[model samples]
Target: MNPSSTLSLLRGICAAALLATATSGGPAAAESWPTVPDELFAALGLERDVPANVLYDAVAARFHDQDQGYGKGKFADLWEPIAISRYFDPGLYEGRDNLDFEVQAGECASCHESVTPGWVHSWDNSVHADLDAIRALPEDDSRAYKKEHLAEVEANLRSMGLLAEGQPLATVGCADCHLGVNVKAGNHKTDLRLPDAAACGQCHVRQFSERESERDTITWPQDQWPAGRPSHALSLQANYETAIWAGMTQREVAEGCTMCHTTQATCNQCHTRHEFSAAQARKPEVCSNCHNGVDHNEFENYMLSRHGIIYQANGDKWDWDKPLSEAFASAGYNAPTCQTCHMGLHGQPTHNLVQKVRWGFAPMRSIADNLDHPFFAERRELWVATCSQCHSPSFANAWLDSMDKGTEQGLRVVEQGNAELKAMYDEGILIGQVTNRPAPPKPDEDAPGGFFGLFWTEGNNPTAIEYRNAQMWEQQLMRQFKGLAHANPGGFTYTHGWSELIGSVAIIRDEATRLREFRELQAKVRELENAADR
Candidate 1:
């Protein structure tokens, strides 16, 4: 049988086994049964006094069904996660729901110290394992805002039966996660490696939820398609192709854009797996995968800024693993990284990147339409507060506002360039063509009239010549948005982006007009020759 078919058969067998066990009994504590409504047991056709072990087995069938759903979520990485979740929920854990796993954490550490020394060392120093330094800060400390998020994480875990609600929450230790009650010591048969982002979501819920959220592909990225511009397949949740190559949805960019999108999740996109070090996560390089190069060059733009220069100069001496409680205090570090602006020690340590920007790269629509709106206002407020940590509010706000206006100015320039392209397209000069390649087969060759639209629309021509025309159109516009957004005014702004944008539009129009006139002259010659022959 085929691989997918074989995997499907195996899953069917597992479900059958779980269902057989579930029909017999489930794991339910007897003393706790009295608190439950008798109607619940009646619905299942079970006795009210069913033990927790019996109740657990009876629910295994449903658990299996639920586990199967993970293999088919929107995320591209689900196969391993579903299998790992089965290990987490053989439904065998039984004991008090102790939230703090300090003693258990030590036991977990004792054995792994020899094998994974580096990972063990990283985990020991990780914020997940300890936050004592943060707790030491005074109650009024601003950076301690992460405490509420941590508490919220513990609460979410407890509600999901992963942690105990009664005890005080601490930094999530290894034991809190590997919480299997009957898991044996030196259990050589069991797999301890559960690195699924879904598993982590029970605790770290917010960021996990945000991984495949809509904001990921909100506007546009480098659209040099058919000429091959990079795109976020997972984030955009679409199949895309380009001129030079194809794109993959997998974490790795294999085979140079041959476009093989896979079932990989963006969960470990930032946090990574295993040791899950906050120190590594805090680095600006983490944001580079999705936020760099071509049109979206904020990460590169930042490198050109004074902040990048400072980090390059004196960052090695600075501590990256500073506690949340002290992060806002700004230890004697000379420069800031991308994290300092977006996820910085501002009062809020959030995963929402949009909260840090007022103008962003594409404020064309937002500035004109939603400038004074609440969402835009809220974002500016957050940015102002974050910037105020370093620069004075007046200085920061004025600087940020000037950028917003710059973006607005950039949009006006784009509108001008757009008008030039629209005129060419409307005048039977720059024709509509599919940007995708291996371009879809051309519509009826003898078709008479032209279609109005050019952007991924039906009934449009798909010629190599047209594809080149579209590429010219797509790339020139990238400068206006990409340059203004990155704050890199030299190359991306006037030099390459906006200044060249106007020039490119004119060149395309002139070429398109030349092509149209040549075609007309050829048709006229054909007409004269036919009349002479008649």
Candidate 2:
């Protein structure tokens, strides 16, 4: 049957009810349908009654398939959010409601097993589905190391006073993570929410604390950049505050920025859903999704390097389920994965990837020798210790020195390009500088449009020379430092780093010369025309 045509039938039912009341000599009611009551709307902070006209229009539109005369009552008022906030969920911003998982836990699996067979199937295979399986394994199990790790996690939970003494461990079912362990939180159908980082932290205390430590890092200059900034702790906020990300009208493109930044939202980005296997996240392939690109190609650099070559050849043979700390011996790994190198600190692996970060991919100015700074020197020493695991102390130190020198040279070249552009900008001779060039996106104070201008453009504002300089600083410089840091010699030299920097430098110089000559020529033409007229 046609959905829209049914709206007339729905209206007829309401009209008949109204007519019956009138003929019986009873007073007519203001509302004909029991949509969302005014009390419910008031509780949601919408401060308005559901209008009969809105109900009639919603029935005609057929917004939802099971249109119960008024079509998804709460969702019908799409405009209500504009007056309050961007997000429309009623209980979303409110503090989490406590749950009674022990009593209500089996309810979710029993229903979803039939409703969403796939969800149930995946959950059935996961360790979260049954902790008894882990407990049943023998003490001398081949993967006995993992059993030990689980014991530690269980003990940690007990220490937090969350896991009560003698309370037998429960399976980490849907409610355990999505809702809490014990209280009156509603049913799964209505109370389900997107679990935040804090929810995961509740159970996986060790991993959660390590990831959250990014907030307390003392790496960057505190006066300039925020302490946790350029780290995963602040990734989502950084995306939201980015000028181009906010200014762009294309919401799809903006959402792409959040794709990688979702790490701040959920553990599933790396761990993934259903299985959420540690072995899968241990592989370098997981990091490749976000880490490969023009700006920061750490994945590409690693793949091309000697370390990546070894992993690609023999990674499958190795046991990835083993802890990252034991990748070399227990896992039979000859070469380091991205996790082994970055997350591996002092022979132990951690979730805080930024703990030992120095010269964080792209530093704007010419930090000639970061070692001079005591904080950076300390981090370099930690890296030296990490590298010394495979190579001699002398060899590790020498390679670091080379990377530092290469980065210093790259920074100087970028600084020279910036100087040239700034000179043009100061002289007020840059193309479209005074006439057509509009300001760049907000929060970025680059008057000459260097870094922030690269994301967006207006007219000829960041003219040819300006664009060349911006690319040199943003893209080429990033490749140079990151390529060196990742131990990809060819990456830093010819592939995408040093060679690209040199090419950009030449282009900037050539563009600057041409622009100056063109400006001089225009002045000469104007002078010649004035003389002829006289």
Candidate 3:
């Protein structure tokens, strides 16, 4: 028989075995099953009296039907039957009411299967599953830390108001964030639920809230900071607050998840179809939606970098889908994708590179622990191997060293600038008397646009003007950084370099202030000489 036929035959045998176990009054009888222990039940927010065997039988039956006697077919199709069965039958597990859990879990899984199937599989492999076959082998210190940290994270979630007041953390499963309800005409309108901004915010509150506070006074950084200009500092702050905060429904905050998770093109926006590979997730383009602007120009930076240039120029000649080989020559350009630097390939018989590397773009320090194991100590060695994909080992090393040095120098400049600013502020050099402080007459009021007539206007201050200019300059500098990092020429020149020039303009304004004072002093001296002559 062919491999497919052989697989189908094996599945048939397994199905028969499952059926025999379920029906017979043998040792596998469901009635004699062990019940879920009170402790475990309590932890899962389930009733202790629940019978584990009944749930197991239901799950086994569903599994058998879905597999069709271990039939050779598409894995997704096979999973569908199991998903449907599990959704309809709550008795697939012990400890709790099957109906309630299944309803929520089913809805979440069904929607995600349509939108992000790969993520659904990834989540299944995640720590969420409770199957004995999938359990990690417990070592002494490792098990202890896992338990402690899990508790810590759960506590953190509760404190952040992501969970209900008395809800157990285990019960805070997939639905807490991903599910949405729509009420219209005093009846349910649509029950379409997908992971949205509010869902991500439940866990990533700090990231979501960082740009919302104290907008008016908070100055943009000098590297990307504005000098003498009018303040529009509150623009981003206002938008985020109004859209994410004041908006009443899930649709209101829909932009949040899409802003970071997708791009302007293609089905791969969430995850690629077919294999739904993990490799695609590590690419920078996935984050282009939100990071395309002046400050966080990850897309621009990656595109302009040597790696991006090489890929763009030569990708057609190489098999991008296959695992990268050491001897593989680049068609023309010399660099790898964002994945090359971060997620190492599987075929290369070296240490796991993804584990050891710390790409600290986001402030979150949470990382998968498998990377730190002793067996993966050669992660740095693997990272070096990535550089060798394009340039010689020596050249790659030197380039990285130079980049590091440049970063250090840039940081130093920022520190020095900040120190000077602090000194000036502390000495009260910024305060001054102005010649005019009059309240200007109001303009003739126009009719309200629609219903709301929200309107206001005010004259600008010199300091405020300078600050706004500095803000624009700051934005430009950030754009330049993105361009340089991504290897995108346009971003490097227009966005990144242009921002630097604007920043220079702001600096000139500061210098001009001192020059103006000097000119006034010279004019006074000339007048005094003329008076003496008279």
Candidate 4:
């Protein structure tokens, strides 16, 4: 068939699907889901009578807007996990239903198995495809719980009207995510959707809820940054909100920020797609993709730490398939991995990564600044308990104290640099402050744009001193505090942390002295010119 013929055929099919959806709304045509629990709808501040499809669409639209109607829709400012705003293509499922889902798996696989064999192979090995095999396991088998979980998921979907009556529970396949409720109206070309976190939440409800809980987690000041910021929950938003990312006309360079910040779009970064292997995600290497760099060298610091050293040497021997809760006792783990520390909370492993986070991964503020605040104090105790799993309570407490001190130390250096630069800018001696230097890009009109100026330069406006100041706070200070947090002493002292900070400070001091002398020379020149005129 020619391209024109194929297009005609797809249009015909889509028209028929829309007619069916519109005309067939009564009891026989449209199926009603079991009544969902009241608390669930109550949480979203919705009446129970609202259809599942309506709620789903509204949630997607929230991300499309400037301010999510958090308090308007719900009594409290509850967060609905969002898709990557740029990737939210509503046209994919504009007018569709899942009536054709029965044939979706076969149709998707028939072509993809040949065109993308690796994807097929990976999915074949994943538990998503082996539902029957998991169900067949003996009652007492170690993996039997997975079968129970699947059943629970099925029940949840059914209650929520996502799984229709008489629709057999099927393995999670391409169409389940991509075509979703729009399977009946979908074609290979225009109808496919990139599944977001909310789409995945349709099945893995608990995990989705946990990930979204980052929004509700305690935030200090309640106003400095958005709630649950500086975390995976708001990572993509942070990228979009960044002045440098928006200011750069070079889109390719700017979009690179999305490579790591896209956690809001899909969970595939950690749980890689096709296979979506939990084992792969459990490893520390998975984190290195985004967590390594000059500013946040978490991966590098962890590698040098004693914990990382043990994982590198003996991790292969350890069982990667087991849950992290079993790491110390049953998984042959002699030391902590990235997941072991960050994901563990309240005595169990969880999908929420920020529950126990105190200082976070950056040098936002030292824990010493708010040690007594309930939010930090409670989590601080949890940290001690987490560490005390391997070491004594006293040892954990002492080490955490040391980390706090290190954080304060790094913060002081950064503060000092900022103060010195601000002084120069105020006194009108800073190089290029008033002249050649252009104001930073929109949303950041501040002169001497510290961090924002790092991305752009014009007429040497963010002079040498400004550059050094941004580096000291943004890059070196981050490394120093993060290094201490990760337990990499060499990382903090030598590699790229405190040692680098000291160097930046020295440069700033030397530059300040020279600038002052240059100003003095200018004054003398002006005085000599006046004498000549007389």
Candidate 5:
């Protein structure tokens, strides 16, 4: 037979089988569709009146029978185990309904054999297979209970939204993320999968909600985007810990696990292709997609630092593959990636999904100060162990101290400059008519311009002119300090130090104008008095 004819026959057979199964609702149907418990069904917005047996029968037949005609053969196989594990798991069904038992016993093994044959054997080795058995132990039991307790420790994930009424604990499962309610069928269907953001938000509601809230407040300069795209890392939450420490409230961190793990875009946004790989996650460039910005320019800083310079000059002479260890010397490596100091000398347990890492980018007032708690106590030992890979204990301690002293000195200088400006302003040596005494002036004619200067003269008021000049000096000092701390020459000049210096000069100019106005007013008053006396 021709290839086209053969393909046509297969389609017809599949379609006919699906129609028969949907209408007939046979034994296969009964066993294929595991009925959700009343509470679960109600939570999912299914009909409570429909008998569990009937629903089971319909779903089973629709899914399993060859004649029922869903064209997704391999796709169905990939989907079934995840669906079963997510929805019909033993714990979720315990008090709700025993209907799943009948369906699971009679049809599950056989149907799964057809759908995902390899998974039948693999399921025995899976973490999910024994989760319920572990959860059944007494709370004090160390062996089994410890695992359960650890899983529930909450990771302090941020919340995004309230749980739908009757929805299970916001834990993840294959079907929960991928499937949707079949409104027409009044049962779950594999159609219309949730968007990645929404799927992740089901558990990570706090982080998701926080990101939305911060979106407007955290803005990027228009020049940052050469092509008119939004600035990198402008949203803040793109870097998980930075976002939280920067300003996110404690309330935003109380949600479940999904919030920070997922992003507005799909996983592939950073990981590239859909088949996520460990190798891709390990690269520094992957993080640069969002982190190459003014606040957290890890990529740019790393490149300019000694670590990045060496990596650029040398190829793969050092071991990039191994976790940082005593054998992994920086002498040979020359330079390091961001993974060196923050992650580890050679990328240790810092970024492990299963375990938290202690070392982090220390939060700062101006990216120069050290955070109060540099080591998250929960993972402190783990981080110290990673440091042991390169430096001796004394060396590491000394290095940290040096870094702290350097940062503090820079900040002190800036603070001193600010104090000087405040003192100058207080003395009133420089004076001005402060049109807008407390706030910057509005860009309107309410304070009239040259065209209507005489008519609007009354609105202008002489205020503390020297004080404004001091304020400008304080701003410049802040920029200089921030640049010195980060060791970024460009950041110090353009973004921090120089920009503030210019602003201070502008304030001085404004103060000078105010002083001139005061003198002019005094002269005019004297002239008027002399005329009256004459």
Candidate 6:
């Protein structure tokens, strides 16, 4: 009812839940989840093994306020998908046993050891399976830090009722992620499918959060939210492709491409989970799926590059599945894979693939942002050092420098389109503009004015002239940046990227002039009509 009473109840209920089911065996707070700690459940008089629907009802009744987690976005946003999953089929968990997944997950190896022997063996040797090795490292080591923090992970599971009482720690199992939240009623189904990225995100909080941030910016210039089904574009942090793909073109499935996995920020886009084999992700093919089109044709360019040439000849001999170490790659790796340059397999390897790509968006000042960026230079050098594993420093620096120059040249074109738009606004042709955020969820029809819409900027009541002009820059300039970023400088210059930018800028300027003339004629018509009436 009151603030003090609600806080007191929340406190008391949490204490009871913890006292009733809590164990000292799980990992500590450092590696814990942003999930509801013991207090929320205990305060509500709900058991850890409560049904999904029942839990949802309680959460709806009690957690009415949108809490801004203990940290910033961690707990608040982290809880979003988990809370949203409450409506998942409760019948799926019908009448299941009190099996502990920590032990049960281990048994998955036995069945797989015979049936899917390769998967089991590969997983056995994976870093995920080697928890003991992780535990033995220094506390400061990230793996060691993760090992020491099982208690929080366990608490998160317990709160969700996914991990029941008497279940041991280390709950990595087939069902934990693969299966949706299980009610206590049914046998575990073997035919279950892949976990949604949102579910995987519950545990892998950081990656998912970055994806959410990236997802925020991933959309085509549109006038509406959830743009009607068959909404053909994936949110790739750019709008031009979306405009081109959805706005300009029609599906040619015979062309052998479709927007299949664009719905949510899929983590498995690269990882290809179940096994989540690192070696598989380290190859070039994983990226070719989405990166090969007109926008960023790195895969096709790599096939032509010295790196791709070598891999084509010798890749089959190189061990595709190897541990990530200083000398993991063979001498046969004379050229780079997508992973070789972006991932830096020759030196320090990391999952943060876009670290070197400091600015994903366009108009990188008069120069590339990476040029003067203190943080960016270190990361870029690290990549070049990896390149130096095969290429000499002079060779690597020269190639990279060319890419930087190409990007600057591309930016000049973007500046032109931008300048054109600015001039239009100056002439009072456009009512206003929207450059920063995506256009507001489609304005009500009764609402006034065209919206100035682009991936980068926004404006209201954007006439056809305004819309087409912005589309020109979004498609053209963005292609230039992406092409260079992908090692296809040609794509950035003559063929697709630069040529397109130049063409689009001309189109934008011409259209803006035509629209102004049309508007002026309309004004004259209105003035003449008034005089005739007089």
Q: Give per-residue CA lDDT, model 5, range 419-529, as digits (tens).
A: 544444454432233433222222212211121221122322223333333333333343344344335565456655555555555555555556557768978999999
Better of 3 and 5 by TM-score: 3
For residues 1-534, what per-residue lDDT tens digits would candidate 6 score against the true structure? 998677646744764454333345332221122232333345557565553334444543321222311111222221122222222211112222443233343355687788888866666665456545644665333233244234344554554556666574443555555454442222344434345445654454323433332212222223223221111112321221233223322234211222333323345667764556556776788888776754455677787666677788988876654433322332245566777666442264433344454444444462254366554576568667876877799987887777777777877876787687777766666544333223433221211112224322233545555555555454556667666665655657777678877887787788678868978998999999999999
The segments of candidate 3 whose C-alpha lies over 4 angstroms from its true place after superposition are 1-192, 196-258, 261-285, 317-335, 345-383, 412-512, 515-534
Q: Choose the strongest candidate by TM-score.
A: 4
What TM-score do all the candidates reach, one by one? 0.56, 0.77, 0.38, 0.81, 0.37, 0.52
Assess the local accuracy of residue 204 in candidate 1 as a C-alpha lDDT between 0 and 100: 56
User: Can you tell me which runs of candidate 2 are displaced by over 4 Å?
Assistant: 1-104, 110-119, 159-162, 182-185, 188-190, 221-224, 364-366
lDDT of 4 at 48: 44
Candidate 4, 1-534: lDDT as tens digits: 998677646744754454344323322111122222233344456554554344444334443344642211221122222333344322113323543333444577777789889988988898888677876876434454465456556644665676675454657777788777425435644456667777776666556655655655636553445566667766766766666666665656555676788786578779887798878899999999999998898999999999999999999999887667668866789998889888887667767787777776555554457767787788889988888778899999999889888888878877776777777788888877667667776656665437776777778767877888888888898888888888999878887777887888788778778888999999999999999999
Winner on TM-score between 2 and 5 is 2
2 versus 4: better TM-score goes to: 4
- Which 10 consecutive positions of candidate 3 have the poorest summed lDDT? 446-455
Q: Residue-wise lDDT of candidate 2 within 1-534, one digit each (tens)?
A: 586557645644654454344334222121422222333223223333333223222222321122221111222222111212112222123332463223365587787778888977877877777777776765334344555445544544554455665454657777767666443345544455556555665555446545655645644753345566576655655555565666555556556666786565567778877777788899999998889887888899999888889889999899876667668855788888888888876677777777677777575453454456767778888888888778888998999899888888888888887877787788787887788887765544556636666667787767877777877878888888888887888778898777887888787777778778998999999999999999
Q: What does candidate 2 score on TM? A: 0.77
Regarding lDDT, does 2 or 3 come out ahead?
2
